[model samples]
Target: MTAIPPSPATAAPLGDGLRFAFGTLTVLPVRVTRWDRGAARTGMLCAPVAGLVVGLAAAALGTALLLLGTGPLLAAVGSAAVPAALTRGLHLDGLADTADGLGSGKPAADALQIMKRSDIGPFGVVTLLFVLLAQVAVLAQAYDGGWARGALAALVSATAARTALTLASRTGVPAARPEGLGAAVAGTVPVRAALLVLAAVTAAAASAGAAFGTYDLIRYALAVLAAVAAAELLLRHCTRRFGGVTGDVFGALAETAATAALVVLATG
Candidate 1:
């Protein structure tokens, strides 16, 4: 077997980290210069930054649509579509694959194979339908409240989605596969670093809400909490079912967190 390529020894950590995160996580044109664990570690740690970029894009489109006089429903749909487009729909696809795998009633190895197949199964299709509906419906509700609310909902939910990936990458999590994205990044993050990143994300979300009022601030933080909680439960379930986390599982977790965050943001 060929030996693994070394990390770019000369590159700055921040540059490599951003490249890895954007290159792997989005359809954006950033080139990934290194594939070694160093880059993966930083990539996972910097996931929220990439998520922030995606969230900003989503928020921008939604705000623009609203300013253009589109109805809340249309603006919500636009906002919801931005994340999918930016990620090339990979997370949504992962969510569907994971649902099919879990719903298959097969052994871990067998279920992995089912998820690896190109076509979506009944469970996958149904899960996608409901997940997309939840995202759009909640977004529409936020947009109905105001452009700021809609944009904040989009921004917070998107960031919370990737924040789950960072937490999921903490030291104890194992990769379900020997090869693939999951194995490359799983267990690479130190526990303290992951928690710190999560705290920062949650705090920033609350700060954004604080501009509105104390209640909004509390709900924003709670939205992040709800997102993390939902993703953690799913992460544990997927680990048990699949033997550990896969790329599909990561995607599922992101979508799960994002939808949960949106749902909470729509409240009050």
Candidate 2:
């Protein structure tokens, strides 16, 4: 039977859009404001879109701050805070748990069990430090160069990371049962929708950078491409190791990929 599409009326509107977006990107774990079992799958599908919107808003804010004479370091730092606010620190928690889980070196199930715990572990601490250092270094470099380039890097890198979520979703099974948001979202993403998002995001980013300098446009494009490749490899490895994806893995991928992208730009 053809499944009836999940509706916003029955689900959380904001959450539903996120689930739809995530489904497009293939990352899962979309939670509605009020939990609704029926809307679980739909919400998972929407997450990527929400993430994209969130990323754009952050980039815009950071770019605006830079234009207003804020240093890149301050602007980058400020921009980063938006995602934490929008997602209520959900991805940051995911980053920590995924690090702990991966670092545990236990069986996948055991590692996931560790992730479920509320306390942060050694792996989480190290991973967070690493990611933060990478981000700061890259952002600092971009800021030193100019505001437009930094904005392009931020926007393109963010879009690419969100796109990677779809690949992650496709590559793994849900870690939990009762078919949580992740499972429901598996195989539900539309390829065309994802491509369109990618195209639009890339175009906008490239245009912005080009307005500043053609060289910057090319540089950001290369960086963004490298970031996407790195994310694909990381997710592929994670999928193979764990037999599926998790919320933490998704967050980790986004942060890692974006940082790597920035670092690449810095070095080049």
Candidate 3:
């Protein structure tokens, strides 16, 4: 059997984690440099950072549309489309597969096999619609009251997704075959870097909440935390059932967290 190559081992120990994570974002095939030392830095950071950038751009466009007299629905739809365009449907694809996998009622391996199929199933379609509807609902509500909060939510939610990746990588093992992107990132990211991303997201969330008197920062925080915890549990289950988390799981976690955040903030 061919062995999965480990991350690199040449770098200094202190910042190797960040370097490895950042490297994963770049266009380099640095998947397996070393294992014990936890050294490779291939292309993992790209997704979250890209999410943030795309989300921000989408929010701006949404806000601009609102200012130009577009209805809340159109603005919300446009904003949601930003990340979709940026990732070119990567997360959505994952989101769909994850929905199908988790909802299929098949064995874990069978569900995973279904996820690997190119065609989206009935469960996948429903999951995608639910996610999109949830996003649009929150966005429309936020825009009706205030676009600033809505935009900030978009930014922070995207960042939170990246942080979720870190949590998954640190806590869960990879699946049997180390062929996909999850294997490329597992155990390679630094906790500190992940914390930094979380901090940034927190700041963004707080700032957004502050704009509206109703922003119950603590409530939103707790909701996000809960979402993360739930995601971790799901990841752990996947690890036990399938040996590790996948890229689709990561994306599903992000979408779940973001949805939870919105719900909490809305209620708060």
For model 3, the local distance difference test gives: 0.63
- Report the error of model 1 at residue 17, Å: 0.8
Instruction: Judge candidate 1 at residue 252 and give its lDDT.
Output: 97
Across 144-190, the per-residue lDDT of candidate 1 in tens digits comes to 88999999999999999999999998878887888788887788788
Per-residue C-alpha lDDT of model 2 across residues 77-129, encoded as one tens digit per residue = 76666666666666677789878887888887788789879999998988888
Pick the winner on TM-score between candidates 1 and 2. 1
Report the Cα lDDT for residue 225, model 1: 88
Worst 10 residues of 1 by lDDT: 1-10
lDDT of 3 at 142: 75
Q: Between candidates 1 and 3, name the one with more favorable TM-score.
A: 1
- Comparison by TM-score, 2 against 3, better one: 3
lDDT (Cα, 0-100) at 78 in candidate 2: 63
Sorted on lDDT, best first, the list reads 1, 3, 2
Best by TM-score: 1
Q: Relative to the unseen true structure, what is the C-alpha lDDT of residue 217 in candidate 1, on a scale of 0 to 100? A: 94
Q: Which window of ten consecutive residues has the lowest lDDT sum in model 3?
A: 25-34
**83, model 3: CA deviation in Å?**
1.1
Stretches of model 3 off by over 4 angstroms after superposition: 1-48, 190-196, 213-216
Using lDDT, give the best candidate's number: 1
TM-score of each: 0.95, 0.75, 0.78
